[model samples]
Target: MKGNWLLLIGAYFSAVFYSTAFCVVTLHVDPESHYLEGGKEGTLEIWLEGVQNSEEVFEFTINVSTNNEDVFEITDKVLVVGSIKSKVPYTTHKAGNALISFEQVSGHHDNADNGTIVSDVGDVYAHIYVIRSQPLNVFNIIVGWIYFTAWSMSFYPQLYENITRRSVVGLNFDFLSFNMLGYIVYSIFNVGLYWIPKVQDEYRDEHPGQLIPVKLNDVFFSLHGGLLTAITIGTCFIYERGNQSVSWICRVSISIGLTYILTLAIISSTDKFPNCTWWHFVSWISYIKLIVTVVKYCPQAYMNYSRQSTTGWSIGNVLLDLTGGICSLLQAFLIAYNSDDWPSLIANPVKFGLGILTIIFDAVFMVQHYILYADAHYSKSGRFLSGGGSKKGYKKIHDSEKGSSENSNFFRT
Candidate 1:
């Protein structure tokens, strides 16, 4: 019992560490990864990366204002990243400072030009407007919410099964604990920003008309953080007491950790935080470690599977996995169409990949349900029939030896 409690504690902390690691790798993005454009500015050649390296030209109307409240304007037609043959000049605006805004030409690519900003001393601020080259939509939020609901709904049956069995037979407390801790850390990340009421006010005032900036990775990580926390708490209850199902629970945990967790972490970390050198290094190392841990425990999972005579997969978990998967898939597609978010999703593929795995697991779980829970005598037929002609005959005496013999075979085999 003491050992079990110790393991449980260990699992909880492990979950915390891994979840934090997962959130960081998946969500953290470096602002420095974007291009900066503020130096001595003559003709600020603003050229965005275009399809096939071809040039797309945009026209801009420049504005300048001084601390002394003097305002001046200029109209210039420029081809970005390409040389200007002729310079168009109006009354040269006083060198105090300048603001440039570029609107795309009508009836071409729907993409527009982000404005370049110049400091009072003619220094370039490398103003980045991530809004160019994309269409905006509400589908991302909608799909994300759907996925959230599905994953959340998965906990019920798992909770019921664990309670009914009076043990965490087919669940893994350690794995779930780590998963939950990750979600908790993630959910709280952007919470600090909310306390600064000024930020909210400023954001609302300047959004769209002004510079509305956000980190894509951070939001997704926060979402995952909350989801995992709920999963962790539910898993803890499932394994609260060691009972007839402990072995199978451990096995299922190992299976999930192997089939999904490691790959999910690796792909997301690499894709989302590629700009963070330290994060990149740590993420790769964690990925390798997680894979190793899962592999090392594969035999243990197999043993439990054999003894349990079931897949040890939970319906609730499968439902969550399936729901999360569909939601994530839609999220990926939605993100893919936008230029700003495309980088983040492409940078971190864990959400996308794990979503796929969850779907596969959902399919397997249905099979497990029919073969195991729905048909209890399915796997035990060979053993039961060798001794007696009827399952009822074995049930009477087997009831007396049920807990011990089953438990013993789990370890001996």
Candidate 2:
């Protein structure tokens, strides 16, 4: 009889154990990453997500860790927060990226300490940036905006120059062709990563616990750039294009680009490479854009060099490109120093190389315009210039535009 009673008690405990799970308590960091000046301090809040309908007051003992001890000093101690949330303060000793993380030591609830167990989530974390110059943070931010705006605005000058001169005589067709192809592929990459849920899911699944790198601004930039390039290409068709055509070299390059993407699409359809998924396709398109960035300016630069003049090519474009490139590189330096993330530059060599390469090409263009080929003015009338090549083209354009050129924007440059 006693054995039967004991068996009934054991059966009851087993059922209870099988039916219930430990209550989970979630802790969230307010800002996943934050910036701070050297020798300054700031606080990041830790908010608790507890079981629903339970008004139980909870407290936890938290522990802290940091990546750089010299730049950041945080000792692991008991964090006693007796409410739903608490602010954690950190101090930056120097200029370095300080990675801060928190661990839960123990936790308690006011009611049902035994029957309702509280399960602790692994960790809550945030970043601490100790920038070299606090005042320069604002400058860095401004430069970031400047580069973005400058790059976006840079496209207009060429478009205007084509309309103003009524000819794309000195504008190398090779440059346009490569640029158009690049923007198209870039738009595809950005749109896929930014909007397509399946691609995002694939990206996240491939890189677990990592944030999606693409943002709405990225989408905006690529799409805006693509639209502008398309319009410019359209203008090429209507405008008086002198003795120039999309070079066979550029045609072959474009063919390769198309073939590369299409072949990847085919491979993705098959199971040849297990890892060649949707995200891989997106990444490959981005690679094409990267390659384009590296080489797009070559044709334009070479064309200027050959012509011994900066006639059709816009100096405004060169100036804006220079502004964007310089700002971009400086901002990169500021960010890398502040975040102690020098490796990230290496990780994204395409973007870094793009900035450096652009700056170099801009310098070359500036030298060509200012010193190497300074004889003639980049004038729309081409009347005062010494070159007959420009004169002949602009005279034809002037005759054609005598009726419509009055409304041309004088302030376009």
Candidate 3:
């Protein structure tokens, strides 16, 4: 009898270990999201994977619920799940956003729903977006790509100016300093969230049922930005930028931003700060980027104001930035309007606020280039302007600080 009892316990322990190590369940809601106009229809393919075939298994119930019933008309029912998979058809009624949740409430065979029986069955969600119209939805998607392209190309104009002119005089040093640091922090945040397994796990745990916000393009953009920004900074070293050096103000600002960013990273690694995780660290880094964006343009704008000319600055970069800002705002509004989720406009204050700020700065640069300083002539020295805007106490301002000393500079735009 003692040997029989020991043999039974050993079998149970092996089964437990096998189930834990080998059997991993994942609930897949195909497509993850659907976009439709009001009164449209869509089908969702639901499959619960990793459940081994067992003769004793009977059935399971996948309870379906929605955050907003107005958007999708879904009928929740007990799906015997013969093969652990089924199709769920849904219809849209009005313009709104909703998440349809699928959770395994119970299992007839195991009599256990908490995953110890077969595998862990967690909640899966599919998004239903019943927009006001199809055109707006298409517009929103198109605008998203447009802004992405615009922002991505914006860097090239400035890079080309520095490379072709071999001069980075009009390009503010403070702007370069802040921009390089911002991209460095941004690249770290993107890489950590997207590539690091530990950070990915923490992010999934913190925001379950939601797709990881960092995507391949985001990772590419951040890294691309860092690389380009670094190259531009290098140009500042090799180019014919006369007496143009990063100011004290820029150094102090960059030092503080980098210090804070590093502190967060260390806190995440050492776990010195309670509940501060890699997710939290990246989040703080992204926020710091927003702060950086707010100030990064200021230096360039101030420099333009002081110099009374945007001779060294590339207007192509400004125009591209303006296009990106416009498209970004348009896309945000289009999405909000189509889904009737107006409040989502402000949901991500950082992203929205950054867009607004970028537009404002672009407008300033445009005015300086196209209107305010359009008539200003670049002298041989650019070290001195014959007659222009404020000359109060602005002595550091130099004409040699301007772009190409030659009037025939092709990068005037």
Candidate 4:
């Protein structure tokens, strides 16, 4: 029985290690990156970058076919930027990298349901390697699906341990709860997006043009998986941090970030975009909170660097985060690659800029995590507290003799 119990514990932690390491890559969520504006006639501009001049970009073809009505006609297909006469109603020529724009018929902007049809415009317009519905992007989809499944499966053991222990000694409650709530809300909202009448109508209208309904998968990744993993890890972190001000700050920051992003998404779902108001101010403030989090966590990152340790950090979690970041970058490439696919009436440069930022930060975070683990001091099981609760528990472990002796006493007790 003792041996069986030991085996189970070993298996459980092993699963945890693997799951956490591959968190982002495995549980990729779709972030909403596209938005639609209703009008009698409207235009969208998609700007493509990182492409060679006069290159035969097979991905540059903008296919727009609608089963509903062929009533619409392009007013101007070619945008005369510099000397290039691209397409009209859709244009391939614009200044800077390359610009693509589309013109839609007036008074037919939205479907019967009247809900906004927004997706990650970046993913749709960009010429990144990963195509949203293309068969070629199956690897990304498969990788993401596997990641999510693994994450969900791994949750059980940690949950069991938490239940048996009753107290989450190393858990961070605030971080966990806020992210849990955020992800839950995000998941439910995504499902709601499917059932919402406006969304359905919009999808029906855009059928053949863009099959999938407006969902968050475009911007961030997978709503359900990302939220679940984030919340789970966050809960552990909050519980571990206890009631310190730092804990409270984390909770508030996460809460604000979740609230701001979710609120913007909700507003974007409506016919009219929720313009700047007090809530908008709050949203921008929340954006700052995210920056603060990165800065605040600098010390933790520094500690990991100084000690050359991925000790207290979960390699599994960091790995997941890195994978998620890569996925986001892929999404960005898709958006920025073909800028001419969208209409000019509803394009926002700020959104694109922010998308760029997300990719950059994600890359940095992932590299840092890898660096920490590559160090000589990197341990398989992160720096977690022993169950004995001794005063020396917080002391860093470096010697095998001290570790073995402590382990013997711990098992003996």
Candidate 5:
């Protein structure tokens, strides 16, 4: 308890420091236009530094311009800053800075050619704008990383448990099959959309204004999902408890049929059948993935219900998955709230809905394991029942043992 308390305290202080560092406001004057001339129009550029750390919509108010009303006129009274990480430095081939541009209107000056002309350039005064702060990025990053970590490690617990027990009796093979299919589709969609040049071109053409930069996190997330799914499938093969109702042939056929149908649908809709744009096909694949994710846990839940126990399933995996799903949902909410982009939430319903459903299913699993079937277990003779009655009586009863033994051989090598 004392160690846990110390860890909590340390985490709290670390979070506080990280948040402070992330939200620190810094501004730099652009060297090119620090000095400005009046009457002659020139852009007065002020760069907002550390904008990458901000995940909220904010306005940098030019309060100084209001004070210099008599001397100078500014075009933009307020500048709206977006939550997107600025690629200005990379694109413009300059140091990193979120550029804020303001047009300086002509200032009042005497005629230089006639009697007397006062140069406004020398006398012109430029003042710094006060930034209205929003520090949602700190929270977003923290929650995002937590979700990533949880998801990345989620499969290990179940895999380890299966290996140690040398059984996959309580696990639903259908659940694994569906999950692997979903991740395969998801990985293809993610990689094709972001990395393929042809897809990038088509996507840019379709949505010219939207800038969705594929970050390192996205790549890692996709890779992690794919890797874990493969590992879990391998573990399932190794720890076969012979309880699988679905045959390998049927599973393979279903996978191929689904893939073909999705592909055909995408191709038929486009002008170019086989040579259609990557973006169009990826959209179809994404929807398939969404459907798969929605129903992914159904098989496991049903198996648990029928067996009245979660004997072979790892509670650690469920807990980690639950944490990851909740964190993912929270991260999305934070992004939408901070950016004031409610439309995005509606636009990507699949991502948001998947998180919500995963969390709900995780909760149900917890209830089944801890409350509903608390004392449920499988007997040595392969009968599943509550562990409250006479153990010898249940063991001696072997009425169903012959049937179970026959079924268990179905998947045996």
Candidate 6:
């Protein structure tokens, strides 16, 4: 027991150390700048440095006016700077040179001594600073893949145990139903936000200089979750225990199907009217997913409480799920740090809350299994505390005519 406790403590610290190291290595801010001549209505050639791809593009904007309130009438101009393949230093003149000229304007300076001071037009120098994005480090990538693998395989142990036992006695169908619907909506939302061009364009416009592209592993993770839930639902149908209500299956299916159809309709409308409509639609779907995830575990927890036993439920699944959830939350933090876009975490509250909620439910399940109902048992000898049944209190019965009975009768001492 002492050794086991030591190992658990060591593992906990190791995880924390590794996550800290990963954040330090991957998250960094490296700002690069260039100076351009700015004055009258003219253009300046801005050199692009460290741009490898000819198709790469950067958002360029010029603020020609002074910071003083006396010169606040100048309007800012925004432009796209694309890489030039033929250039020696790979510049962005082809896309459009920086227009560093602003209209001449005059404004009153609110000074205590001077009642009003008018400012004249002057030459304004522009400093172009680009917020460069660094690709994820190899260690972070490996950790992400590990998280994906753990999440993808989390349900397999429970599925295998159910099959081996040929009973779904301990598993709560309501929980599975909610979980399936949640994953379906989550998968749709992820794909719509990532693959839909309109949504992607809006996201980029709203959040400039931030990289939040959805990876292939993310798609796989959602799909895997949906697939596992579907399998579990099938198993429930096949091996449903005595007198259990399986009628909820049809209701949940129809509701999910209709919701999916409506989601598709909203996504399709984006093609005709392309704008921020898709973003709103996807956001609603994400909220639904979050709410479902938050409530999905309640039914199972209640079931365990009412029955006073955790029999037939696999603890292995809970442990794996806990590990995956912690890793997922850590990965999200790392990404937010790396991109320097902490607001993005709040922008997608569902994704932000999923890992935390999963870990909480998994911990509750562990408590229910190993702590609350540790000695409770459901057996043929009737409901009794584990190790309470005694062979000495049972009498074997024998039949005549060369027949013997394996049944035994139990009596109190």
Best by lDDT: 3
**Tens digit of per-residue lDDT, candidate 6, span 213-325:** 67667777888899988997787666534333433543565487567659656775767655436665665666667777777788788767766656556788888888878
Per-residue lDDT of model 4, residues 1-413, tens digit only: 99999999999999886553332211011121222211223244433222222221212233333212332333432222211223323222221122222331111112222211122322342111111233324444565555445444433444444434432333333434444444454444455445456544444344422334334442233354555556455444323222222344555666676676667666654637435332233334434433543343344454444443433344454444445445544544543332323332125555445545544544544555454244333223322322211322233544431122122221121
- Estimate candidate 4's alpha-carbon lDDT, on a 0 to 1 scale: 0.38
Report the number of the highest-TM-score candidate. 3
Q: Backbone collision count in every prediction?
A: 16, 0, 5, 78, 1, 0
RMSD of each: 20.2, 8.2, 5.9, 21.9, 19.0, 22.1
lDDT of 1 by residue, 1-413 (tens): 99999999999999976553332111010121222122221333343321221232333333332222222334544433222232433232222223344443321222434322211212112222222222233556677777776765665666566555544433543444444434443333333233335444434343322332334444554565466447545544434322333345445644664555445546645656534332233333334333332332243234334443332335666667677777777767655544233555656565455456556656655554555334343222112111222324322223322323333222222
Each candidate structure's TM-score, on Cα atoms with residue i matched to residue i, is 0.41, 0.74, 0.84, 0.38, 0.61, 0.56
Q: Across residues 309-357, which tens digit of lDDT does each residue of candidate 2 receive?
A: 6778889998998998898888888777766667766677768877788
Off by over 4 Å in 3: 1-23, 54-69, 80-84, 110-120, 272-274, 379-413
For model 5, the superposed segments whose C-alpha errors exceed 4 Å read 1-134, 247-253, 265-275, 378-413
Every candidate's lDDT: 0.41, 0.70, 0.73, 0.38, 0.58, 0.54
Q: Please give me the total number of clashing residue pairs in predicted model 2.
A: 0
> lDDT score, residue 294, model 4?
37
Model 3 lDDT tens row, 299-362: 8898888777787788998898899899889888888888888888998887888889889999
Tell me which of candidates 5 and 6 scores higher on TM-score: 5
Candidate 1 TM-score versus the reference: 0.41
Sorted on lDDT, best first, the list reads 3, 2, 5, 6, 1, 4
What does candidate 5's lDDT look like per residue over 304-409, in tens digits?
7766567777899999999998888787766655544446566777678777888899999999888776766564543443431222332222233122434554
Q: Report clash pairs, candidate 2.
A: none
